[model samples]
Target: MKLQLETIIIFVQNINRLKSFYVDLLKLNILEEIPSEWLLLQAGGCNIGLHKMGEHYPNKSEGDFKFDNNTKIVFETDQDIRSIRASLMNEKVPMKEVKTFDNYPYWLCDGEDPEGNVFQIKQRKV
Candidate 1:
């Protein structure tokens, strides 16, 4: 048969920060939010859910902490890559240089959210 993916839940230490990044920054629509507990955002056909990390998850001191995860979230845009990248940079979002391989049809840039979750912004090169 066929399996469908509904939501992707990421355990985070701070829900508001994630909400700010995914909703405020990336412009994803929020489906639900429970303060300091959970946040659900709509990203195209799928939903991204942020669940507050419990006490079992170790947190470093309040300064610099980056979550090391094997997965990366990718966002596709119809807008110009350079323009979008500039906008995010102006908002103080940490982003890498936009690049594309010789034969690649898409231009891509990588960046991290407030809590250090890796994400990519992509657009087709015209």
Candidate 2:
């Protein structure tokens, strides 16, 4: 038996806000959405789904962003990583500087989604 990766579901506090962040800021296409419930987006070969968290979930809105998460979603891009980083920063999205190691052949940058989930964008060095 074989299983293929399809979707990554993120439990979120505000569905619309996350939807806008992925759709408008990240430029992901929506595959399916149920208003304030669940949303599925086209993220290249895989899909990203945003699920509204239950009322019992704790809301973290009063502290500095803790980069303590274990998972980071990455998006490959053909454009310049610096421009992408700058564009996201213009929208107030917390983004890190584009970096590449001495032997690395790809330029990469990391940023946070509206809900503080970490995401990275990479462009192959030409």
lDDT of each: 0.74, 0.75
Candidate 1 deviation (Cα RMSD): 13.0
Q: Write the per-residue lDDT of candidate 2 for residues 1-126, one digit (tens) a residue.
A: 122344566777789988889999999998877899988899987888787776544645424443444445667777777887888899999887788877767787777899888777878899
In angstroms, give how far residue 18 of model 2 lies from its true place.
31
Error at 34, model 2, angstroms? 42
Every candidate's CA RMSD: 13.0, 13.0
lDDT of 1 by residue, 1-126 (tens): 122344556777778887889888999998876788878789888778787876645654333434466345667777787888888889998888999876767788877898788677778788
Prediction 2 TM-score vs. true: 0.49
Model 1 stretches with alpha carbons more than 4 Å out: 1-67
Candidate 2: where is the Cα deviation over 4 Å?
Answer: 1-65
